[model samples]
Target: MNVAFDKPSPWQRIQPVFQGFDLPLVFIVAFLCGLGLVNMYSVGFDNGSRFFDQARNMLLAAGVLFLVAQVPPQRLMALAVPVYTVGVLLLVATALFGLTKKGATRWLNLGLVIQPSEVMKIAAPLMLAWWFQRREGQLRPLDFAVACGLLLVPVALVLKQPDLGTSLLVLSSGLYVIFFAGLNWRLILPVLLAGAIGITLIVSYQGDLCQPGVKWVGLHDYQKNRVCTLLDPTTDPLGKGFHIIQGMIAIGSGGVTGKGFMQGTQTHLEFIPERTTDFVFAAYSEEHGLVGNLLLMAGFLALIFRGLVIAAQAPTLFSRLLAGSLSLSFFTYAFVNMGMVSGILPVVGVPLPFISYGGTAMVTLGLALGMLMSIAKSRGLMQR
Candidate 1:
């Protein structure tokens, strides 16, 4: 019954794995990963498997990091179109024969349940970056329009699936590629102004305008309810408004120093909904308080800033566009999730990047970081 304990040779053990290392990108990912572990611990204490699952996810992410790091940025660019095409086909399949949950069809089944929209998150950026690379020195209005078309196709499909959060993420990621490709600010300024005006109009006349059959054409009923809930959580405190009210209460109850880890009354009392998933932020806030929240935000900011620096230093247009879009996409994920949980934004199901608990999201984020690492490592190699 003796087990083989003999260790393999050093090269056999390490050569395939550690053949190439991107130090800066690896450090940034490891730091964010450490923060995710802490946040998961805070929210997942009573849930026996979540902590272990998170650890397993981290290992899987590291493996992704290694695999993607080995690929050159040019290779990723070359794979962009076929990858994006496959992703779109999957999205179409999801719409046709997908699994529906909570009234939305967002996942496809091929022996395993998978979310096709997550693939678009990566594909959108990759595809746009590839487009920009082709038109690098000759980027023109038509090229920008084509890039927009690339973004709009997947975004429209996702939005049709009625997954607003993911649709926005995909849209924003593609827009980041456009911005990085030297888009005209004159064109962007008008859109921003119009958006601000639209927000003002919505908030000003929300009561009458949102009272069913309003002029707003795109928003779904549940989406409208979430916005209304954000405006005034007390509107239906015990029904559709329960999530925001409880989340705010949990966050406020944390006070200055917090109730300490695993000691949060609201969380342990089971008042917070989605405690281990989208609203994990509220649980973390309740346990860690303002000080802890600030620390968490600071860690996120550091990661984003480092990512942008990597993007800025990337040698090629494709690498820069890909890195920049991925970096900003991370920012969007944090902002949207925190804003929703804090009642400042509509409740769209955007996970808080690495911190929130979900296997698909964690893997998508790992893939993004791997892209950034690929860009960073390429730049490092070029400089040498």
Candidate 2:
């Protein structure tokens, strides 16, 4: 007897793979990518090269998103330690012999000027989540200490590079992992109280303490200047304080309705510093006004909420921790950027997500969202 086996059709062969795709997650990412393209067009109208560069970056990010989406969460857990180790070593190397620009040595020149510290923003959380996943059944205080150590090592090094914005992001991302992994509220309360007291004292005695030659120990001069400028930009209105003052003016001038797209005088006239980067939101606000800002904020809020839902439904501890941390990290990025631009917080050079013109940050965000989609898909698989 001769038997012939039936061949599977292409759709049958790929059905399992296609079923794993998360449409909601894909929609969220595509929306952000579209917004990025729109903002890049407006910001770089005079500079065609920047517009093309942003397009290239977006394509690369889309590739990363697809590649990462294919990765299983279990595999990500296994790779976390190795990725984190390499990222830490890069940070160490950056400290020793990195390229310096504008008084900060945050990038390494290896044929390309790479900011290795950007790696830590994702790696730190991945490493921490993996650690917690390993100790899922029986966690202890020592495990938390180890996780904290994993976070602090890179954070301290990045802060020393004087890129305070990215350092804080990395630190916050790691801390979110720890928090989601059953960190005790009792332990956290004391630290929060201490932070409150410190902020109060700083604001209460700002004049006496922020004087020139007062010898603030840890903070760099530029960092200190940012804090002082936030408190009172009038002190150096035309000097070091110009950025904050101009940003605030642009934001306020928008009133209830924006100046219309490409009609922003502050942005086109070059009144705003870093219009395509850290202060992109201010430029956006100038053009779109209050209604535009509200729309932008709503989109961010929806994205964060969707991410949280994905985290809650994640199949494993690693997925949950990574998804939760990444979501909160996104929130921190928006908060810091908007806060600084609105003159409510210090200018720490944090980029506005999906709005700012930067390649590294765009790639980082793509990787993060991809991980979330991976987790979400895994959760659906487990449910089925």
Candidate 3:
């Protein structure tokens, strides 16, 4: 029997790693990644090693995705509470003794710089999903209230870090989980109505409110400036408004069919600020135009739609809630990034997913995608 034994091929050895993968999700992500690489090369070739660095980041993210996808949803539930606890602790530590940059203390140094808020992006949803799962059928309003308390603690910590973008992402991720766990719409609609009224009031009284030293009570000085700038960028055409004005110029110049690929003068000539990072969508628009924007949006919609489908088909309550929240978080990221670039929303530090060059955000995105895939795979296995 020991005479002639043949070893399995390399493909066979690694096959189990991808045994129950979701094809549509894989294809959609691959399409977006291809677009990202092309855009990076075109927009970042002159920005030193940005193009290469981004490629490396994407590769690292891919490795993270594969590793995370292999973890079953049950295992993920087991890790949620601990991950959430650690993330909140890190945020607290950051507030007490963190590295400050540009007037915000958002990063921690534990041999390496890390943003604890990014961890909450996934951990918040995971923790919430796991919470509801424990109370599966015997859910009470008190259960929902307790879940809100768990979510608000981390959210408040991140906000105190004054990292508004990361805080919003964390808040929304947890809210999505709560909503999925069946919080009453009666509670949600009133908040939405109040927000609408607040926005209307802000716009109507912008002139009086935005005057120098008026001092909005809750917001920081810079935060007030961002909102005021968004209301009417022309008020500070050269100083605070430069980013928005330049971004609008680049986007509008793209026209119907765009300036064509690497031929974008606004992008190539360096008119768009942060062309390789936060304002990447502006650079992309300058090169690809409206047609490109539509296609890009279509890709995002496909990703969101597919993710929701997986959530609906998820075999467990935890999987369902986690998948749904992560799916909508993608919407929040894309909507806020694009809205800011297009001059419709206040500019914060949110990045255009797959299109922007951020190692941390890319890894966070990979983890979210991996969770989606894990849930999808679990659903398939259950059916089988």
Candidate 4:
């Protein structure tokens, strides 16, 4: 009575794969990718390669999402420590003896130029989720301290590399996990208050701090310039502030219904800097207008909502924590990128998630979506 089963037919094998996938999330991601393609084509008219590379990145990301979706949450948990350890060690290696370019040492050379900081974006949250999962019932203050230590090491290293953007991203990802794990409100409020106070101080002292040759404490000269320029872009109108000024002008010119498609004069006239990358949003807003912006926001909110639903349905603490953190981190990525492009926040080189033309960020987002799909898939497997 122990006869071996035969292989499933091609259709039979393919049917379950599609059925197991999270269709709503799939639709949301597809819509965003399609929007990205349109925007890339429109903004990258001067150089079509960005449009092509963005397409390639989307394909690579899809493959990653599909493959990762096949794995169960429990199995993914097993990878937490190993992946995090490797990612951090690589970061340390990057800090000690790594490649330097453009006055920043964030890259590594292993026969190829690679950025190690990018990997921590996912690894930090995964590792923290696993740690919290293990100490679910017996969590203590010291556990939070250890968790903070785990989160800070790579963040500190990335800071040493002086990559404010990636470090902030990584830090936010880890903090999402920490926040989701029942962290006390008392501990969170002080940080928020301090941040508010710091912003106020910076704005008030803008005139004094922004003077030429005045260096900021614990921040690079260029970094301080960015903050000061954000306070008042007219301070360096044609130089450091050009990008922000041009971006805001482009955004404001869009009006209610935008300039329509490729008719954005600012984009075509080359006023917006890095139209295909960090400042792509301005180009998008200039073309798509308010209605288009609302649609895009809706798409992101839909995706985030689905992610939170998946987190709620997750079967384990680790899965729940990871899913929630990934979801919020996705939100943070979009918020900061859009805020930066709109001249409301300092430009820290964060891409606009799926819309921005970059391989590493797309891959990271794919991995996160794949994890969400995997968690959803795990819930299905349990019900069966």
Full-model lDDT for every candidate: 0.87, 0.89, 0.93, 0.92
Number of clashes recorded per candidate? 0, 0, 0, 0
Number of the top-ranking candidate, with TM-score as the measure: 3
- Model 2 misplacement above 4 A: 1-16
Could you tell me every candidate's TM-score relative to the true structure?
0.94, 0.96, 0.97, 0.96
Model 2: which residue pairs collide? none
What is the C-alpha lDDT profile of model 2 across 74-156, one tens digit per residue? 98999999999999999999999999998999999889889999999999999999999989999999999999998999999
- Which has the better lDDT: candidate 1, or candidate 3? 3
The true-versus-predicted C-alpha distance at residue 32 of model 4, in Å, is 0.5
| Tens digits of per-residue lDDT for model 3, 288-351 | 9999999999999999999999999999999999999999999999999999988999999899
Candidate 2 has its poorest 10 consecutive residues by lDDT at 28-37
Write model 4 residue lDDT over 142-258, tens digit each, in one string: 999899999999999998889998989999999999999989999999999999999999888878878889888889888998898899999779999999999999999998899
Give the per-residue lDDT digits (tens) of candidate 1, residues 34-78: 877877886786887898899898888777877887888989988
Relative to the true structure, candidate 1 has a C-alpha RMSD (angstroms) of: 4.8
**What lDDT is obtained when candidate 4 is compared to the true structure?**
0.92
Clashes of 2: 0
Which lDDT value does model 3 have at 274?
92
